[model samples]
Target chain A: MRRRIPQLVCGLFGLVTFLCYFSSHPIARKIYLTVTLDYWQIIFAFTLIVGALSFVRVNLRAVERGEDRPYKIVSLIGVVLMPILALIWGIRGGSPFMWVFENIQVPMQATVFSLLAFFVASASYRGFRARSLQAAILLGAALLILISRSSIGDLIWDRIPEAAEWVRSNPAMSARRAILIGIGLGSLTTSVRVLVGIERTWLGGEK
Target chain B: MDVGTLVAGLLTLAILTFLYRDNPIYKMAESLLIGVAIGYVLVVTWTNSLMALLFTPLFSRGELWLIVPFALGFLMFGRLHRRTAILSRIPIGVLIGSGAGVAIPAMLEARTLRQLSATVGPVFADGTVDISMVVVLLGVLSTLIYFYFSREQVGWWGRTARLGTWFLMIFFGTTFGYTVMSRMSTFIGRMEFLLSDFLRIIS
Candidate 1:
């Protein structure tokens, strides 16, 4: 009974929402907009709380187990401190909360992402070996694109940039479009399955 | 020197320290990042979403129907308890159903139909046989064929799929090259920040 009720609710909502897209009726449109804009936002807020609680639980357990205790403690402190700062000072552009965000968070994120450059370089060095036809083609294309984007391509040959652009717009774009179509079809099938109550993984384990 | 810039520089260096080796400083920075991210999200979600959308309308506008969603949102917390976990599935069901409902038509129209139309359209300009257009058309057709896993890739189909593989390789190589360029640009930006803003070594 527990599982069946949720599945029915899912199918009913799914059908209604799907119909709302096609229906020009004022009531249907209103319901669609309200469910999407208002209800979704509220649900997402609760989901965020759930996520935060999970984070606290995992890290607290780690700290209690004395596994990476110092770092876990530091993480917990940051989680606790930032919200308190926001609540007390507000998150206005010039507030301390924003300061920490702009200075600390932004810089940390950028630097971490920037580290990817080194990893990519190392990965390319190891993976871009030209032992076969496909490998040779891939290596050549990668090198050509990389060089064309840099000053060295213009220094070497004037037509390199044009060739790179042609490769990107022609073969690359076509392949990308094909992939998109496949994704679209797959997503549509999944949506239909969910709407019809054939897919119930979202309900979690059987209760 | 401003305290903000100094702190930013320190954090950036702490993160960059990971490139050398995983150490205590890097671990500390990583933990701090996760913590601050959660905190930031919590504040934004509470103030912008919960307060502005849920609370204001329910209280100020006296929208009694808002209670339904509020109750559903509250029920999501039942997930924390084993016995009442079944209650959480109702909200989860609705979220997935509504989300899937919204995505269906959009994906078909925007992704599949549009791409199909674009692929089958004119492969040349007026009075000119465009080579690029031919390549694009062939590439699209062959790639789609390659992705068809239901049938055996034999004879003509196999050769066509092989050609499609080459096209895919070129696409992936270009993507990787572009990604490398992007990451390099990011790296350069941080270097510029460190040199000019932090150290005052450049104008």
Candidate 2:
């Protein structure tokens, strides 16, 4: 009954949503809007909150077990502190919550992401071997783009950027379009499968 | 120095410490970043989504249908307990189904049909054969054929598929190059902050 009920719900909602697109009836449009906007947002928010709560629970358990105690505590402190700060001052601009977010979260996040550049450079150094035709083409394209984007390329050859732009707009764009089409078809099939109960993986195992 | 710059600078430096090697400081900064990011999301979701969408409508405006989503959302917490875990599937089903439903027409219109139309739109312009459009058409065709695995790839089909891969590689290379450049810019921004904002080495 548990599995059947959810499957029915999935199929029903999927059918309704899919049908709503073709229908201009006010109720259909309203249902579509309500489902997409309100219900989706509320459900998504709760999902996120649940995820954050789970993180806290897992970290608390770890702290209890004496695993990376100080770091876990620091994480827990950040988690706990932000809400309290928000509650006390609100998340308005220039509030303490925003202050922590701008200073602590944003900078750290940017720096961490920026760290990827060094890793990418090192990885490219090790892995970007051009021993084959395809590899050569890939390497050539990457080098062309890199050169075109920088000032040194213009100094070396003014048309380098133009050539890179041609590669980007024509061949690269065509391939990207093909991939998008493939993704579109794939999504359609997957959605249909889920709706039809063929893709019960979301139900999470054979209960 | 102002506290914001000082704190941001120190944390930024702490994160950059990971490049040297993962150390306690880097781990600490990473952990704090995760926690704070989650907390920020929680706050934003509560204020923007839960408060405005769900609570305001249900409590103030007395929208009764809003209760359905509230109940579905509440069911998501069933995931935390094994006994009640199956209840979570109902909400998951609704989310997936509705998302998939909307995506059906959206993907077809935007990704597939639009791309097809654009590709087949114009192969000639101003009384001359537009070479770029022709190439785009050929690229799209060859790429699609490359993915058609129903038949064995051999002869001319093999060649077209191989050409498709070259085009794909070009696309991938361009994407990689762009990503690297973006990250490089971010890295530059961080360096500027460290040098100009923090150390006052440059104005």
Candidate 3:
């Protein structure tokens, strides 16, 4: 009953949504909009909350196990504190919640991503080896782009930027278009599969 | 510096300490970042989605249809327990099913048909040979052919597929370069913040 019912619901919703696209009827439009906008967000928000609770549970478990308790506790505090702050002070500008977001969250996140710059540089040293023609081509393209984007490319040759632009617009664009087409077709098929209940993997193991 | 600047600068430095090695300071900041990010998302989702859509309409405005979503959303909490875990599948199924339905037409129209049309469109423009257009056409065709795994790749097909790899390589290289450059710029930005805001070393 559990497996069959969910599959039935999936097929029903999928079929309705698919049919709504060819439908200009107001009822269809209403159904489509309500599902896409309201229900999507509501359900998605619930999932996020569930995920947050699960994170808390995991951290609490770790703390119980004495595995990096301090860090886990810090994480727990962070998870617990933000919502409390938002609830009390509200998340508006000049609020504690916003303050944490702007100062603590934003700076830390930016620094974390920026730290990847060093790793990417280290990676390129290993990745840019040109033992094969393809490797050489890849290296050349990267170098061309890097140089063109920097201040020194115009010093070496004025056409470096133009050549880089040409490579991007023509060759790179072609590959991108092909990739997009592949993704589109893939998504279409998968959506159809989901509609037909062939993709019941989401229902989990053992029915 | 003000407290906000000082706190941000310190947190930024703490995160940057991973360059030396992964230590207590970096892990602390990383944990806090993850937790705080979740909290921020929770607040945002509650305010923007749950409260506004589900709660406001259903309770404040007396729109009864919202109970449907509320009930579905409540089912999501079933994931917390082993016995009730099966109930979560109903919401997941609905989300995935509707999402897939919406994606079908969108994927066909925007990604597939539009791209296909744009690729073939310019080549046929004015019946004149534009070198760039020709390159683009060749690139798209060869790349697609490379992805076609149904046939055994040999002879002319093999060569075409090989040409596709070169285009793919160029694409990868360009993307990698852009990513590195962007990250480098952000790193530079953090440095600027530290120097100008925190240390007052640079104007």
Candidate 4:
């Protein structure tokens, strides 16, 4: 009974979704959208509970081990208290939980990103050398885009923006589109396996 | 300025401080971020997935079919066991197969055909070449030739290919640099918001 549950789902909805695309029936598309956006969205949403449980389990274990005990306790407190407060009162634009969120999480994500900036400049200084014809062209493109992006570049050369725009629209967008196709293909392969009931790792182990 | 956006902005600045050097402000900003992410995930899941999907269906349909994904999702917990862990493959396989069905054709059409056709396209489009078409044709030819590593060059073909390679290299280099700056800007943008918004809490 336990084993049959997920296979049943993939079979029912997954099969319908696959068939829906080629079918002329409007119902197929509607059902497809509902299953994907509504049903799949629900399943994915609840997965967060899995993460919260893991967070609690690891942090509590850390507290038991007498290592980084203080931080672990603080983490556990935040994990527990914030959610309780949120569920009881709700979190939105003006609530305290929401306030804590905007003030805190945004900064952390931003800080991680900012650190990436210094790393960028350092990498540029060290590695931005031309070794071949291809390297030289790439460097030229980089220079064009860089100058055009900042106000300084606009002052030096009016053509920089136009040139950069052309490159991005033509070459960069083309390359990114190519990569996205590859990624899309890869995603399809995974999804097909899931639908067929042959993939099942998300269910926790192999059948 | 609204009090909410103001507090959020301060935290953003505090985070950006790390661009210069790490400090107490940065740490405070970091801690706040972790809390918020955790909180967001919980709240979002509860409202979006739980309330909308499961709870709604349970109340409205009284249909037991909703338990299908729920039960299978619980099977994800089977990984904790020692011997029976292979059971995880059930859900994973379905995910993989479904993913493949959608992705494979998309991959071929978008990645392979569109690009090959795009490169060979401009010249043939409307059965004629304009000035812009000429430049695009030249760009494509040169870039393609640039990658030819083993082709011996002693004739016109060799010289043309060499120029092609040169054009490709310069284009790639500048692109690399701009990508770096964009990343930095993203980082800066986040911190600027935090410092400007969150610091208001103290003030």
Candidate 1 deviant stretches above 4 angstroms: none
Over 4 Å off, model 4: A1-16, A177-207, B1-32, B60-63, B80-84, B108-120, B124-128, B131-178, B184-203
Which residue pairs come into collision in candidate 1? none
Greater-DockQ candidate between 1 and 3? 3
Better of 1 and 3 by TM-score: 3
Please report, as a residue range, the 10-residue window in candidate 3 chain B with the lowest summed lDDT: B120-129
For residues B1-203, write the lDDT of model 2, one tens digit per residue. 89999999999989988878989999999999988988898999999999999999899999998999999999999988889889889999999989889988998999899999989967778899999999999899999999999988999999999999999999999999998999999999999999999999999
TM-score per candidate, chains pooled: 0.97, 0.98, 0.98, 0.75
User: TM-score ranking from best to worst?
Assistant: 2, 3, 1, 4
Evaluated with TM-score, which candidate comes out highest?
Answer: 2
Q: Given candidate 1, what's the lDDT at residue B144? A: 90
Candidate 2 regions exceeding 4 Å error are none
Q: Write the per-residue lDDT of candidate 3 for residues A38-84, one digit (tens) a residue.
A: 99999999999999999999999999999999999999999999999
lDDT of 3 at B103: 94
Residue-level lDDT of model 3, residues B1-203, one tens digit each, is 78999999999999999999999999999999999999999999999999989898899999999999999999999999999999999999899889999999999999999998888856546767788888888999999999999998899999999999899889988988889899989999999999999999999
Model 3's chain B yields a TM-score of: 0.97
Whichever of 1 and 4 has more DockQ, that candidate is 1
lDDT of each residue in B46-71, candidate 4, tens digit only: 87787777877876878676776666
- Could you tell me how far off, in angstroms, the CA of residue B94 lies in candidate 2 after the best superposition? 0.3
For candidate 2, what is the DockQ-based docking class? high
